[model samples]
Target: MKRISNLLIAFVAIEHILFLIMEMFLWQTPFVIQRFNMTEQIAKDSALLAMNQGLYNGFLAAGLIWSLLIRSYVEQAFKIKLFFLSCVVIAGIFGALTVKISILVIQALPALIGLVVVYLSKPQENYDVVI
Candidate 1:
């Protein structure tokens, strides 16, 4: 269960890293334009904002990766993973509400699953503390 949880967390982190690349560096590319259904002018005009959003995604990815690196302290790792996964789920929901419904499936669903798995995989002794 721990291994599965970690894999899911890594998957979410990698997804965010890909998002960061797409939003920050490839926002104006033809593929991105087609994928986003945006006109060239719109893509050009919104590139900076997309870059900022991408940076935030990168931060989320970084936090999840940081949590993975804290191997010595299981409780600390659980807390960090929980926080970042929650953030991803919330961000995905917000994006879905404000931008597109697809965001819910694309961004939120995996993180939500990961969050649940991580919670379930927590050390038994740590169950006494609220997450």
Candidate 2:
């Protein structure tokens, strides 16, 4: 369960990294334009905003990676992961509401699942600490 949870977390982190790349560096590319279903004019108009959004995505990825690196302090690691995963879920939900519904499935769902898995994988005695 721990391994599975970690893998899911990693997957979410990687997805955000890709999002960072796409929104920041490739917002004007034909591939990104098609993937986002944006006209060239729209893409160009929104390039700066997309880059800012992408920087936030990069921060999310960084936080998740930081959580993964805290191996010695289990409780601290769990807390960090919970916070970042919750942020991802909330961000995804917001994006879905404001931008596109696909954001729910693509961004939130995996993090939600990962959150559950991570919670489940926690040691039974650690429940008190988490609460």
Using all chains and alpha carbons, the TM-scores for the candidates as numbered come to 0.96, 0.94
- Over the stretch 1-131, how does candidate 2's per-residue lDDT look in tens digits? 99999999999999999999999999999999998899999999999999999999999999999999999988888888999999999999999999999999999999999999988898555355442
lDDT of 1 by residue, 1-131 (tens): 99999999999999999999999999999999999899999999999999999999999999999999999988889999999999999999999999989999999999999999999889766345455
Model 1: what TM-score?
A: 0.96
Model 2 score (lDDT): 0.93
Please, what's the RMSD in Å of model 1? 1.1
Q: Lowest-scoring 10 consecutive residues by lDDT in candidate 1?
A: 122-131
Candidate closest to the true structure, highest lDDT: 1
